[model samples]
Target: MLPFFTNPYPDELLYSAIARYHFYSGNLDCKDTLEELFGSRSVIPSVEIGSNFTILAEKLGHQYSVESLLTNHTIYPYYASFLSKQRQQEILENVKGDGQGLYTRLGIVAGGICRKDGLYYCSTCAKADAECYGEPYIHREHQLQGIDYCSHHEIPLRKYPKTNDSRIEYIRFELKHMDLSPLYEIDSHKELAIHLAKQAYKLLNLPLHYLSREQINSKYRTLLREYNLITSSNRVRQQEMYQAIKSTLPNSFLQRYESAVNNNDEYNWLRILTRNLKRHVHPFRHLLFLYFLQYSVEKLVDIDEDDGAFGRGPFSCLNKAAAHYKKFIISNVIVTRDFKTKNLIGTFTCSCGFIYSRKHTTDMFEIGRIKAFGDVWLEKLHDLQQQNLSIRAIARELGVDFKTVKRYLIGNVEIKQVKSHRDNDDILGIYKQDLLKEIKKHPNLSRTALRNKYKKQYMYLYRYDKVWLDEALPERRYGQNTIKKVNWAKRDQQYVQEINRLHQKLLQSEKPIRITISKIGKSLGTLANLEQHLNKLPKTNKLLNDIVESVKDFQLRRCYKIIDDLLENDQEIFLWQIQRKAAIKSHHFHAIQPMLESYIEMKQEVTNNERTTS
Candidate 1:
């Protein structure tokens, strides 16, 4: 091996260390340093991720390896963490050799988000480096695409002027060329910029293949569901989600990175990021989206093993007739969709063979419909029937309807008839003839009216010759003339109780669903009635007026939910974070701005008081 090379500094780019070698080795050209380090003068230097590390490792002796250089000295880990295992291996191999197609494979060449045109450095970091090590080196974190601020300093980074020969030359940081002045004044966007920087830095330091593409996708889908960006039908609410992300970051900040969302463009970077996990997205876009989701690198990688619409199984059986009722013995769940509602429906099958289905939600336990009662239930029904129990009593015992009991036990039951002279053929024929004559006389009247007009003849034929009576009567016409009066007071009382129960349920739900009159009415299957006859149901009307939420009210509830989430995690409360999580538009947040601030202040006081007392 040649004379000792310049050692890499903490988080220094491999390129930066090599450029320092060129300066220290008295090399007149970068190619000379390349030849000495890589044993090949034609190996091109990449700013972010350098190539041909295998040769450089050999020239540098046993002190370094290709894998070590790639993982430690270069920015490969940040991008590799989001790639598949096979792709990570492919990129590692490429970095070890000539690195042909490396940028293409990493999706950087055409990654939409533009990389910095020249080397970037933080003034504070550079000054500190100069004092500590007698020189400053290019930091890998500073050179990342879409990272505008220094993660450590939380200040805007300055860019070094590029030379005309940048394509062939490796630029080293020089104290003389450093512009230590601030690049831009701190504004409202600075906080967001710093967030991106910090998250990007964390990703840069992550271990290779820390997360796979599938894991990231799963994590995203789960979070999307939590944020209400995905429907119960497993469909991504793309437009609403897009607007939420768009509002999270300032337009100028996104524009600077060439990552601005185009509303009309169907194939924008954000859409592509969520749509296709196999297609590589630049780490910049990935980090940006993670910010929109209120996630850090650690949180995004902490994926749930089962993040399906219906979460992990060993689901509970809802069969009331079985021995394992409400027990978590079911390991099988067949997920399908409701053809009419397009909502996800999960069918649970137990070992006892009882089957049932319901609409899928995180905490839903009620069965929508039963597909089969299985053999155990049928045997139970037979045993119950052996006691000569009435159909209603059997239904109550077996957890079914009286009609269901009758349908199942009809063939086994014996019907007894009393002997009567009305059953005679001549008498039945006379009753049928009289019913047919009455029906012909009242052709315009309904069957009920005809029956009322000829009550004696109808009753005689109804008991003795019901089938003949039905055939002789005309088809009943259901018109306004046949309408009956309804008891409005009874209907009102029934609806009020149902609405009250639903209101209580909404209050206990973990996720906030906006309460409106329409939502409450539709959920209780009384929308049409509530819409037209709400005034008639005075109690329901009053309860609705008191519970239905306005736009601002719903937004405030969301803010409170977000606050509770932060407190549960022991995270500090921040207005920007609350706003982002709540997904409230800026103008709308203004409406509840004072209340949010007051609530936060109150919570802080309580927390502080508790700490003081302890």
Candidate 2:
């Protein structure tokens, strides 16, 4: 068995511990140390080194498994919670079998790499480690990309340079052996840097389970709804949410992490987060969203099915006389009904026998209606009443309505009666006789005109006095002296004569114009009338149909005319020039290409024979 170090630091990574072991054991070569520990020499170490936990545990003679080492030291815990169950198991198997090769499979590289140039180490942490443990090592938290400062110390980390060649397999974290760069203070965005660092630190050290995609999506939607970043029907307010997220995170931080979505891109990551997540998102993205929403990892990971639904409850108990008075244990829920009207009811009940309900379509409650005030509130009201305080005054003192004070004085605890439509009908009855007299005075007037003239009376009568109003008002008559009948046969003959005249006039023109239905109808100024009587105007229809040409035929005719013009001018005929002059598109020329080719061949042969005879 290989001798390994005991008492590793709380934040020490597995790679750092192994590197320390290599140092303490006087091993000079990293490749040799890896070969001895993992029983393989094909391993390549990256900044985010992983997958050697089981091998290390076995070699160190420890009883703990790979899961323990990963949860305590690596950043896998943060990413694992956002991955699927199958993915989490796959990650564990890969880590136990292969060292430093699971980042791609785990989707950590999906957002592109944002790590610093080389190895990072906090000067304060290194000094503390050397003073306490006799040596300093690389911290896994500081090694994470986009984390500029140490989470604990809130100080900028220093970088260590390395060769660009891949020949260097693994570097041991020795403060004296490495060339450490000078540290610089973070001039701007110090608070943002520190906050992100602390969150990353928490993620690295905390032990969390894989949160289902559904769970994460639910948590995000809940936050969006709370912020009014989504519509009631669950469509995301993309523009608003995008602006809010952009304003919340610094531009430099977003650019560094590659999380900045452009304003014009419709299918950005923020939109995808609100939609059904079809694939696993990177952990950094999840952390970025959590940070923007002002939520910690603990809160996000602890979200349950009961949470982010209906209302965030442990609502205050209104029953003051009960043992749990004023305690937040009551639950306000929305009870849905199948009917359209009165479909929802908000119910609030305490375990102490006090119940209050309000009919509302939403789940929100009226705080003043929580009548759970116990005997103490009643006693105060009673004292005030005895001291000659008015109902309004007593209600103002107790922070309740005058009706509530009156109810308490009357010793009645029943719920107040809700107003119904019948009351409105009584109010409308006052104007019933006047409306009837007006309708009788103008019997020929249309119902719509009368209703508009007396809108309120008509609406009330339409709702409550349907039978009487229908009988009193005249019938809604259509086609009353408005529409006139026409002899279609005579009109058809007139249209045919007009079309023929227009066509003859076009034929006599200096430039022949195409005879079309629109042209004929427009000349006669009866386009609408001709269209309306088209079925009866068979002669006109037949004449127009005979003149219509297919697109290919029209293009061929135009090309022939161009060729005739070119021949008469004794100009050299070019196919491209002919097509351009004819205004024929490429597809049209292709359709009548055989005729064009034959004409070109005939013209070429005649020219060749003339040259021979000459």
Using TM-score, give the best candidate's number: 1
For residues 436-506, what per-residue lDDT tens digits would candidate 2 score against the true structure? 78878887889889888888888878888788888878788777777787887777777777777776677
lDDT score at residue 410, model 1, on the 0-100 scale = 75
Against the hidden reference, what TM-scores do the models get? 0.59, 0.52
Q: What TM-score would you give candidate 1 relative to the actual structure? A: 0.59
**Which candidate has the highest lDDT of all?**
1
Model 1 lDDT at residue 606:
90
- Distance from true location, Cα of 530 in model 2, Å: 28
- Off-target runs (Cα >4 Å) in candidate 2 are 5-7, 24-31, 99-101, 164-168, 177-182, 210-214, 298-614
Model 1 local distance difference test score: 0.80
